[model samples]
Target: MGVKAWLSKPLAAYVHKKHQSWIQNPVEAQQSVFESIIKTAQHTAFGRDHHFSEIKTHADFVEAVPVRDYEGLVAYFNRVKEGEQNILWPGKPLYLAKTSGTTSGTKYIPITKDSIPNHINGAKDALLSYIHETGNSSFLDGKMIFLSGSPVLEQVGGIHTGRLSGIANHHVPGYLRTNQLPSYETNCIEDWETKLDQIIEETIDENMTLISGIPPWVQMYFDKLMQQTGKQIKDIFPNFSLFVYGGVNFEPYRKKLFESIGREVDSVETFPASEGFFAYQNEQHDRGLLLLLNSGIFFEFIPTDEYFNEKPTRLTIGEVEVGVNYALVVSSNAGLWGYSIGDTVKFTSVKPYKLIVSGRIKHYISAFGEHVIGEEVEKAMQRTMQKYPMVELVEFTVAPYVSQDKGQSFHEWLVEFSIAPANEEAFAKELNAQLQKLNTYYDDLITGRILADLKIRALPQGTFRHYMKSQGKLGGQNKVPRLSNDRKLAEGLIESADALNTNKN
Candidate 1:
């Protein structure tokens, strides 16, 4: 056996043992994690203020800390950004991950030493879990490429701030450094298009065994690779065996990705987010990611339907039931206390505690993995509407046009305009461009034809009112859903609007 192949046996063994122990007594494991974090930060301002000394049990902890989103945490984060140590965690965070949050403003999530290991070790153990399950260790023998965000970190306060990818780029272990693809310089390129070109040039001839990224961006790479070489991905990298993906559902992208590669290969789905490395695929199964029970993060689940209530019930790991959508809450060493990350998930298994990502608690359109949240679309529309001074939007909803029978698939925007734009075609063109500028993932998808241009359908002013009335939800805090993953809401609006035209005749 080779050095890498030999090394993996021990690695896989370690992951299996740790995972086994984690699932065995999850309740005590979680309680221990919660206590460790609270005790470690007990001397901090937040700890003292919350009277961490009196907190001894889960009930006490729950009562002391309430679930909060970015809005509530931002005050503490502002102190952290200003170089205040022990405000949240024991020491200052070395880096911050900048990402879009529940608000229109950007969020800067602190990344501390204690929290960083969860990202690295969790990823390692997840890959090791796959190896343990399938006996595939040959992947370690060749280069593995991770298509990630730029590593060019910007200095904020006394620390650096960038994407979670940028922070991780600095800590690639020596053992894996030699086996990682896309040279450091190329990985640091700010512009994704330029960086992608360099990655293709640098690793085209290498013995690549694994590829990792969000699917849409990876599909763009695969398409570009095929176009450049006039050969399939399997032909280019005969040893390519694994595809690791997260950030969006893989079902819609699976067929396209397999076609791009020209063959079937092992794929592993994970549930890593900027907030923390939450879960990963341990078995060859769809729609269930094993929860990271032993990670230094205490978890809570709130049913989606009751989340908006003033005092919603928060269920612990022991209390969660399978098949119910719950908004996840986490209290971790990262100094986030009972923070809600906005993503909702449904538990699929109880014994090992597995879950499937359902959708967002916030309304957003991620139909093709673009993750185009409401703030982004709304901001783009507000900017585009500046030129059309006389136009007034009554209501609107966006949906994916994903019919294979239809030649060109696009995002169909059904809008109710009280006052119409001077030129509807010009309005649509400008709106599309604004969206491209707001979201890099959407732009990349558009460039690759993974998605087509945005199309607008104008409706009369009362279309929204009529549609809502049909649903018996008229006029009392009742609003149309702004976005949808499927065509149900969009089709309803279109049909309702068409009936208005028929009546006008």
Candidate 2:
């Protein structure tokens, strides 16, 4: 075994021992954890005198702290940006993790030292879970590759902030850190073209044993690698053993990734956010088990129905059952209290807390496992649409449709434009190509001709406004849902697009 592997085993053992205890008695663990979290929040300067008062009991604490969306946190951080200390946690925040927000564009999320441990311990649990599930201890030895977000820490008003992926890279254990690839912190490039090129240069001829990242970004890298080397990923990284990914669903991208690599490798799905690493794929690749950061944060789950209507019912870890979707709520040392990160998950097995990511409770769609959420589709569309100056998109929505013939499902993109392209068909084709290129699962589904259909409808300039008005949500906080997974909602969007087109002509 390599030196890294030799060192990792004992570390893994220690982690597993602690983890087993928590998993075995999740209820007692959570109750004990909640009490400590309340203490931290009550005593910490950041937590004291905030919106929430001291949570008396675990039950009252969960009840008092209502579930919050991204906007609420953004508002809190904006206060922090204006030199307001103790917004979320005690002391000055170490840094902020910038992420694309659903309604508020780009968001700056605070990360404190207290919050950092949650991420670290969560990652450790993820690694240990992988080892236990796959029965492969060799992964502990392999050089791991993480296809992460741009690591460029932007200096916002003298405070450095960037994506959590980048921040986490800077915080990994020093001894375990490898020099095989360009450090994310140093090789920071936001431009996809420049970033992909840099990544190619760094990864070339590297003996990477594990790969991790968001699904689309990783697929993009794999496609570029194949084109440049003329050799499949398996040929390049023969030692590759595990494909670890989080942030987005890998099911849609799985077949394509496996095809390029020539075979299926051990895959682990992690549910990590700027706030915390929530869940990790266990020994079984089928479902991700919730490895609650008992030492760092307290967690609650609100029923999916409650979240959709903006009513939050806080559920303890012990109370969560299988087959029911729940919106995750968390309170951490980082200063966030009863924060809802907007992810919807369903428990597959309660004993070990194995859960499957159902979909985003807001702003995403996942039909046939394509998992094209709002932010991802928007980013890809923006990047591709910008390529052609003539193709100006005022607004758009991607909704899933089921064909009447065989009840087969497909994605219909409804785009409203200020000006129509001379080559509208070509624009549509290119849009599909860009989506496929960015995410291989979409590419495979489109190419293999498995999905029902991929259609694009271009409407008049004010079509979006008309549609929004019809829905009685013309302005303010309401925006077009990027990925409309609901069949009825998809059909409604299609009708609106048709109505706009009819009015234009």
Candidate 3:
């Protein structure tokens, strides 16, 4: 190890020792964070309107604030966007994280000075945790790259605003700044393809060690590099050791990513969003990401089955149980209260509050009441991949095929394959069998013949990327929905893939 890597081991040990204080006493840490944020925001407009002063316990806070998604709280966010101070949190926000929205067009989530550290430190400690465990921090001496959004911020109502990743770029520690790659000018290129080309040009010859990004984009980077240089990633960057990823599950992309790299590299998964930095993989195991209890965000969970009820039972860390899917809710210093971040998680370990993201509340295939979720499909796919070792997938999505005629309905899977399985029909059957094993409701439908066995439609290569580019969301945290109830996205994928194939021909 280099001097820097050698020194990081001691620092990593110190950080891990400090983190144990909360990891051991999670409930107390959560309670402290709850009191701190509530007390701080009590004077703000939302707090006063919700009777924050009268609140003393979790029940009191729950009664004072009703759980709401972005649509329900847009009024307060609108006021803030129009230059209102203390509308949600004290004074003005430090920055607004701009994100694409389906109905709202664009959302501006507040990131206060106090809350930003949680975002920065959660990522930092993940790396430190890895170093503390493996004592391998030599990667620190080599170049690192975080494929991210443009760092250019646009002023919104007198506040600096940009994508969450872009906002995070400005806060990278000075120590790591020298090791980071893809020049500022290159990152600012709004288009993903251009930015990626520039990235390859800049980092191809560097001793790259760590690469961080959402899996799809990183896959694209690898694909481009291999195409350009005719060499696997390991050959190009022999020192590369760590891969940091978030936004989506990694299992689906694991095979292809490893095949591209030509070897297995240690990786850390993080659970972050515009709302807050929630969790990170503290250990190099499948134990699940460790939830942040001492961060500036207080968490709440509603059982997924009860999320749509008139008033769902909100469970605090003390009440949450392992193996139950819960809709994640939060009250954060960033001025979001009883906010549903649209994510569903299941605690894998209640002691340390380690959880795996299950799926999104709005993104599922329940058209026939089977309620197939992202986690189920991902697990099913992982099983199928294990069964068919030769198969390699680029991307896939599922949607219900509701029949208007007298024909039986079924689920449709659109998949893009880099290495197609030997027998497509057999591959589809294995996938369907795996899905039935994971979801009993789906199994019942299949057995009863209420729904036909799921159908697989092989999509042309580059179809998903082409579709994303056509929609103006080619990179920087944009992800294809894993499952949808309706056929809107399914139909679009078919059309886009057909068009792409035609144009190529």
Q: Which order, best to worst by lDDT?
A: 3, 1, 2
Q: Ten consecutive residues with minimal summed lDDT in candidate 3?
A: 98-107
What CA RMSD would candidate 2 show?
Answer: 7.8
Write down the RMSD of all candidates, one decimal each.
Answer: 2.7, 7.8, 14.3
Q: Write the per-residue lDDT of candidate 3 for residues 107-213, one digit (tens) a residue.
A: 78999888999889988988999999888898999999998878999998889999888999999998888898888899888767667789999999999999998
What tens-digit string does per-residue lDDT give for candidate 2 at 1-505? 7766666667677777877887898788887877766776565543555424555776666455556776766667787666566556655678888765545656677787777887877876787756655556675575667666556677764567887877887777776676334565435665555666777887777778878776656766787798899999999889888887776555656777788898778877777788777777766636656767466667788898877565566788878888999987778777777788777888888877778778777766655545455766777678767877876778888886643333334678877777767787777777777676555446545653445446777765777787778899988999777767665655666677778778778
CA lDDT of 328 in candidate 2? 79
| Top of the candidates by TM-score | 1
lDDT of 2: 0.70
Q: Give residue 55's lDDT in candidate 3 (0 to 100).
A: 88
Q: lDDT score, residue 88, model 1?
A: 88
TM-score of each: 0.92, 0.75, 0.75
TM-score of predicted structure 1:
0.92
How many residue pairs of model 3 clash at the backbone? 0
